[model samples]
Target chain A: MSSNMMTEVLNLQANQLNAGASASLEAVLNAPPEARAELSALMKLAARMKRWLIPVRPSSAYRARLRDGLQLAAGHQETHRALVETRPRVPQWGWLIGAAALGSAAGIIAMILRRRQTRKDASVAESAR
Target chain B: MEAEEQLIERAKRDATAFGELYERYVDRIYNYIYYRVGNHADAEDLAARVFYRALGNIARYKQRGAPFAAWLYRIAHNLVANFHRDAARRREVPLDDIVAVAEKRAGPSQIAEQNEDARVVLEAMRALPAERQQIVILKFSEGLSNAEIGKLIGRSEGAIKSLYHRTLIALRAELVKRGAE
Candidate 1:
């Protein structure tokens, strides 16, 4: 009849479906005769759909082959991952070189200042004489 | 026996553990792909790929309260989608394939009737949207409950019910249309 009525009917059917099998059957049995037939038909349709596509087992040969392939691949992946995790961490070369250069410059500057002071002291001593 | 979660955890680092997980799910995944693609060769290829990809990414898998099977189904769903996109072609389920399935049970006359019905329904299924097709396959082929289906597809149970109801209606309409033709 009306769209809202149709929506309500569909909602009722959906609720029944979500309730699982025994409850659904109980719902169907208790439904008014007028609605029962349609609901029953829908349920039959679902069952028929299941029957229509019978689950076919994959060939044993293919299954075995795939299993072997996956095992090999997994072994390789595990090895790679282990290598990555266990590998030693390398020191950052840039920072090490920079620190060494800074130390050498500081040492040279100190030596130059000491030499200047010594020369100044010698000049002072000569003047006193 | 260790719980599935522990097995999956071990599987993340252990190849033998991963192999155990594969044994548990390979058939269901194969059947799912078979229904989707309607052929043995492609189903086999895709099913293998699903496991291979899962093995490659197992370390990234987290236990988010859903079953591990849900994760595998999600992978299968995506790969099937990609397959359709790449092929850019409609499915053509050969009669022989339907016959082979039907032959698994029933007499000759019953097999004949089943083959026709299977073909008709499969053809009608193709006309439905992709989501609807997946719902049907998960519900019918794998016998998953609506809640399980919802978990795999990342939908609420209520949403799955609504979709399932709508899907049946759509299938009926399609079947009627085909009958009229």
Candidate 2:
């Protein structure tokens, strides 16, 4: 059989399986007689594959433990969130830091000017004397 | 959905509400992780982390009409990927573990045969590309539709169908190469 025909058959079988319909070995009606056995094998294999990965539940102990853990973590998170919501909002640290730097620079400049004035005043006093 | 959304809204600010959400999705997320990792211990740990991360980021969660479970699946997916990366090796599913989960009433010989087949199938499954492995797990283990799997993996439904078909083919080839009937 041509590859396209084979692909068509496989895809038809896939569509059936995906739709939650069982793809029995005899389900490949469109395939040529020569390819029917191979197509049927593939379909049967796909169905068996689905059954192999059966859904297994987590143990009750693990489930309860994880739930408790989430609760505790969520409690901490809620407390932190509440604190954030109720706490007074502060200005951005960048703005506050910029203001502090400007203030420090101004203070330093003022001190330097005052010292220069005092030195000038003392020199003037000496010159006057 | 309104109830779930209201629960999610409350969960953002209330711990107990989040607990309700936890109860609803714990099994599903666990089952997804269990199949991906093929073990319970790692599945439990990863499942716990998924909820923790989800809880931490609940405040940022927006209801965009995608199911809330999708977001949790994303978390589980990322963690499982990291687990594989960190382990730095592919771990085979223990045949005994698979057998233990089999039907209890089966005779010892039948159970042994079933376990061997399961082991072969799981080995082939693990050998597939990561995306294919994920497709198989979500489809078979979680019973998600192609559209649902597409949404979870950010693919269109058509893309999911193609990928799933290819995955099955690859799995069959792998099984045949392994001498599995």
Candidate 3:
């Protein structure tokens, strides 16, 4: 390849690492067979460097809000979490558990009072007889 | 086959499904951030912040006209921009920093090449206003479409592709002239 062509080829090679990578590669692959053959080794080298250097992966989570005021769900919140922190998210569950324990204890206390009343009633009847 | 559709579907109601998305993109985002910030500690922290911001704003995500990854990079670009803006540093990466990535991605010589690539790219990146680097990293390393990239960075598609192509030419010349050193 001429030096200018080499520069063009190398620049094209760089784009193979761009976000437009597939498009660029498709453009090349669709070219004449001679061109493809000529670029094959360079393509492989570019691919190798890309895979090694600028490997593409989505490591950041993207969130776009379409409408306002909708509550976003929380995820992977350890960003600023204290080592010993455990956040309570569901208020309903806490309320339910507390209410249930309270109800159970009230039931037991009511049962004890009823038993005492029955014994008092039996004693009053025996005294009357 | 359909990464975007799968991410959108899982992210719909399941909050933990967002974590799955986090798992999918964490390393790539980390590396991208690492490439920019040039440190693992900062990369990890920024990576977490990016996801945190995503979770905080998940309800606002619109999958139409934009791929999921682009939106995330948009957030990352903003955070890194703010980071550079508020810091003592000019966000210039030392050549040695690429060495850290070297051990994992390539051998010593390959590391040298990547380091050289990093030097060239980082200089060009730092030479650019923050806005340009935002486009460069997302377009080149993250492999986003110009339209997708434009949406994230708030530029027209025409402007993006042109800028992208121009940046590549500059990057190549810069690398060849100074990178192999």
Which candidate number has the best DockQ? Answer: 2
Tens digit of per-residue lDDT, candidate 2, span B126-180: 7788789888888777778778888887788778777876787798889888888
Docking class of 2: acceptable
* Deviation of model 3 at B150, angstroms: 5.0
Candidate 1 C-alpha lDDT tens digits along B3-120 = 8999999999999999999999999999888888888878999999999999989999999988898889889989988887886555677777788868566888988987888888
Q: Score the docking of each candidate (DockQ).
A: 0.36, 0.47, 0.08
Candidate 1: stretches off by over 4 Å: A1-41, A91-129, B88-91, B103-110
> How far does residue A37 in candidate 3 sit from its true spot (Å)?
24
Ranking of all predicted structures according to lDDT, beginning with the best and ending with the worst: 2, 1, 3
RMSD (CA, angstroms), candidate 2 = 4.2
Worst 10 residues of 1 chain A by lDDT: A14-23
Per-residue C-alpha lDDT of model 1 across residues A1-129, encoded as one tens digit per residue: 332343345545444444443224654575577777766666666656766766688989999999999999998998999999999998989999999999999999999999999999999999999
Candidate 1 chain B worst ten-residue window by lDDT: B87-96
Model 2 ranges with Cα > 4 A deviation:
A1-22, A89-93, A103-129, B88-90
- Taken over the whole model, the C-alpha lDDT of each candidate is 0.81, 0.81, 0.60
lDDT of 3 by residue, B1-181 (tens): 3376677666655565775676667666666676567655566567768877887776567777665766787788788877777767554565445664454656778778766655555654555556666666665566666676778767787677567545544544444576432
For model 3 the local lDDT of residue A119 reads 99
